[model samples]
Target: MFDMENTTVLDRPMLDELVPSRYALKIGEIDVLVISDGVLPLPTTMLAHNAEPAVREAWLNDMYLPKDAFDWALNVMVARSGGRTILIDAGLGLDPDLQLPRAGQLMKRLEAAGVNLGSVTDLVLTHMHMDHIGGLLVDGVKRQLRPDLQIHVSAAEVEFWRSPDFSRTAMPPGFPDALRATANHFMEEYGSHLRTFESSHEVAPGVVVRRTGGHTPGHSVVRLASGGEGLTFAGDAVFAVGFEQPNWHNGFEHDPEEAARVRIDLLRELAESGEMLVATHLPFPSVCRVAAEGEVFRWVPVFWDY
Candidate 1:
């Protein structure tokens, strides 16, 4: 039995899950909690559209991953700084059309972790992707949240979703439609409450979110610095394969070329700074650092501190 009853898991009653769903760490004086929204299984082709089938298969085989679809880790973050609670990127809510039941666990997991929606003073979205903002659309979630919740997102992101261009993307048959509809719905529900920014904004002391459009027109990444420690919650700007193959284009990128450029730049920057990183679709608790070896980069997951 995987019992956490006598563990340091925030002292909440966990259900269904046998392992910890949240990982807590600190940066300076800021409190950071990396929560597992859950794993989203998607087709392998979606990972690298620009690479040849043989090369992609070889990489997957080297990692011991299946040749077919695999689970992509969906992670979100909660930050406490300046006496404010901030939620970064909500997780994938229920999507009957997507048939992805493994995801959308954020709501329940958050509650189990002793996080109350009403306590979230601010929300920062990296972009308006359905998976990133879907948790808000979950029934009754809105009612549970505080009325004056400030949702910070880039102005460019909101405008792009108005008539999102999927022509450049390489999503599955129904993916584009689902993304479009979900983004539209998210705006419909939370548009009026959005706190739009142009380039960068300090949501709270020691926490900054900056636009780094690549995967999406308004893609953004959040950075936290305090007490000489820094960490970046790199939304979709980086991925599991991003470090090793920064040039490979993910199928979800609207402008894959720009996305590749963005990935390469960000990886190089992180490698130099040695700041920690956590991405949306990286493995759960994707707390890792970037290491450079000449042209390519490496992913060094931080040792778990349970």
Candidate 2:
């Protein structure tokens, strides 16, 4: 069984201070802001789910990350266009009892940026996982962080997450507590703004949603374009520098093979189209340029002065 009884509140001092070089980037007429919610402490064994021992080991070594400690970064993206503000995903909320201090800093960063969370017009949830939806609710009262912001989710994702079979599917045992709580919070407090879209739907004028299921039954990716340049917000499809190697499949994916295929195909398409890729877990300030190197790929960090 999983150890899921901790109710410790996360504070600023318990978070690690690992900020990405790029804090914000402007594409066309839109402003894309990146904020870190902190990182997850996962084990290396979690990445080799279906892979052979040797194969997984080799991939781990190639990535240069610790084979024993596989911690992943969690970042949130905020976009502004034509007087509209949208948040890509909610960050992991505060865990006050944890040692990490920097978690739950998105609100502070937004305040510093002069953007109010309450004024956000829309919230595009890529998936319903804890790291992505934990911040969706306010602590204690079970209320949405932005009660007025419209919430857009793929129809399939909503159906899968709310389905009776969700518990039977391959999920972390602790998934129910947080995810179910988030679902309930949304249903009760913010159901008015909840909107579900079908495949390849548009959430806004320039914001397009595409189905990229793998990590979850109905995972979706957001594509934004303004002025002329294109920017794609890949929720959890590419975590960290793993986007550089499209074939590198982490164990977090519910369907490793399908995830690998989506990653590889996305890398190829993004490489050719020259669209800026936004990685929710690719180090905070999580926007980068991807390049194809033979059969593999590489990440070129986009430097912003902050």
Best by lDDT: 1
Score residue 40 of candidate 2 by CA lDDT: 74
What is each predicted model's overall lDDT from 0 to 1?
Answer: 0.89, 0.69
Give each model a TM-score.
Answer: 0.95, 0.81
- Model 2 per-residue lDDT tens digits across residues 1-306: 111122122355333233432256677777777777767776665554555667767767887877776666778887777677888888776655434454555555554455556778888888877677766554642342455567888877777766524422333455556566666655665567778887777766688878888777678899989888998989888865455446555655767678878888888888898888887777766677888888888887766553
All-Cα superposition RMSD per candidate = 3.0, 7.3
For residues 101-136, write the lDDT of model 1, one tens digit per residue.
Answer: 888999888777668899999999998888999999
Structure candidate 1, residue pairs in collision: 28-226
Off by over 4 Å in 2: 1-22, 95-102, 140-147, 164-181
Residue 266's lDDT within candidate 1 is: 87
Best by TM-score: 1
Question: lDDT of candidate 1?
Answer: 0.89
